[model samples]
Target: MNVSGIDIAIQKSERKTVSIFIERDGSVSARVPAKLNDDEIKDILEAKEYQIFKNLAEWTQLNENAVEREYVNGQSFLYLGRNYRLKIVKESSGIVRFFRNTFYLGEKDQPKAKELFIQFYKEKLNSKIHPIIERYKDQLGVAPQQIKVMELQNRWASCTPSGNVNFHWKCAMAPIDVLHYMVVHELAHLIHNNHTQAFWNEVDKILPNYDEQINWLKINGSGMDL
Candidate 1:
């Protein structure tokens, strides 16, 4: 349903309460009770109009900073919050390597550069993620079955029903501190399944300034791409 110049995706479910959230593409979605009629749905949206518009505006502003990258020489890439200039070389060797403030890539590997970078991200995530998880496992009092990094849309990380924590490889692109926030945020989910106040309190206990990391992702996440 398009309301007041904003497009809202309405989903009906057996769930009792109404829930609304903005997507990564700056779109709005609301899950309503399956029995609600169009009129009732409209009323619910009307009642939450203020919140809808507020979040929509924030999404718009945040996505305005989206970055479009090219696999060309002199392009800049982000690794652990630092900017590194790309240096394309004709020599066929490693697909990507970081050295002396530059990210070196093989010119012949241009077509496969994205895949190589994904592997690089997975490598980076594997190196630090487990240690961080171990650091917080005792505090959160929950142990994950495993940690895996993969490509994901719309979320930075998620906790599985079986207690596995999966993170998006793109997460490796963020600052180490921000990455920690993602780890702790997902770890908190092991104890609480929903984003209730208690869940947030758990996150706060692990990272007091988690809101800053969240805001950082809000503003810069669009640029955290291949």
Candidate 2:
């Protein structure tokens, strides 16, 4: 589908709502009910034209900071906001590990090193996020059903309508304090569904330095990828 001179990929399903978003690769997409025709989808996009352009501009600005990382010796990757050099080693066990101030990947596994890094981040997020959530449940008056760490295309984290909170695994690569900011951001959504003044107030009450964290993400988010 095409709208406002931009091509959009429309996916129709049994879903009853219509929503549009920009993808990680800068493509536009719309998810609508299967019965909705192309003209109706175009109308919906037309109605949201302003929001779509705004988000596209923001995405462009964020991608300007994108990092090009090569999987080779001496290539640097982030973990807890610290840079670690890549070191490929010849070993029978194909695995990736952080040791001696370097990230070690078995020579045989270098072809899939990005997957290993993702798994490593998931492990770190699993071990770290639960405690933080527990500490804030009382203060925020919201207890989520579960906290999951996974990959997200265009968001750092999200609080589902069911009260479950999911944080992107890339969040584990951020500084501990920054990661906490992301947790608070999603948790605040458990109270406010949208970004209203009340939501900012709630976030401020918990993390007084939330702006710094927000700025950090705006500047460094593109670098969080593999």
Instruction: Compute each candidate's TM-score over C-alphas.
Output: 0.89, 0.78
Q: How much lDDT does each candidate structure score?
A: 0.87, 0.85
Question: TM-score of the candidate numbered 1?
Answer: 0.89
**How well is each residue in 91-144 modelled by candidate 2, as lDDT tens digits?**
825557888789888888888888888998899889988888888878999889
How accurate locally is residue 214 in candidate 2, as Cα lDDT from 0 to 100?
80
lDDT of 2: 0.85
Worst 10 residues of 1 by lDDT: 90-99
- Cα lDDT tens digits, model 1, 102-170, are 988898888898888888888988897888888988998998997899877877899998999999888
The C-alpha stretches of model 2 lying farther than 4 A from their native spots are 1-3, 7-58
Best of the candidates, TM-score: 1
